[model samples]
Target: RPIFWVGNERTTDHIHSILTESEPWFEFDTSRLEYINRIKFWRYLLGNESFDADYWLTRVENDFE
Candidate 1:
């Protein structure tokens, strides 16, 4: 399984646009996509703090907050 790392929501949108506009044959596996917080990962890797798993999950935006 290949992992697609999307830095932020904007990047995700950009990738989607490219895929929709150019590559009609490329099919992405949503299950292998990893959305992570780079800063959090850096801090954790440096032993600054523990890893935050919650931050890595996609934060869905609903019509009603």
Candidate 2:
């Protein structure tokens, strides 16, 4: 499946209502850093604080139109 988020990085203020109601989401314990063909990636689990979730809704709309 494809995954994405919408808006600026600070996105929790938008989706907390829906996400907080359903489950006890947990943040990753460590950064997901890896190397692929000498290219390195660094991903940290800021949990809800990570990406702008509002971006998700926007993406859906974009796809629909």
Candidate 3:
């Protein structure tokens, strides 16, 4: 098996949806610092004013393409 860096959260989430909806041949690294930073970066870009995890979780997911 080969490891692929999916780049950002949206792609990761989209890939995750596909994986869970079917038989997945790939895995993701959603826990890495880079992934975390991408999420935060998006939040920053989107004017994330709420510090609540719940808000951030939804906000990040919504920012996904």
Off by over 4 Å in 3: 1-31, 49-65
Worst 10 residues of 2 by lDDT: 31-40
lDDT of 3 by residue, 1-65 (tens): 12576455433345223222322442354343344455566558769644233243455556645
User: Candidate 2, TM-score vs. the true structure?
Assistant: 0.19
What tens digits encode model 1's per-residue C-alpha lDDT throughout 1-65? 12465455433344323222323443454322322344345556778664333433334322355
The order of the candidates by TM-score, greatest first, is 3, 1, 2
Give the better candidate number (1 or 3) by lDDT.
3
Per-residue lDDT of model 2, residues 1-65, tens digit only: 12366546544443333332332343332211111101111113443222433243334335542
Q: Which pairs, if any, clash in model 3? A: none
lDDT against true structure, model 1: 0.39
Those runs of model 1 whose alpha carbons end farther than 4 Å from true positions after fitting are 1-36, 50-65
lDDT of 3 at 28: 57
TM-score for each candidate, following the candidate numbering:
0.20, 0.19, 0.30
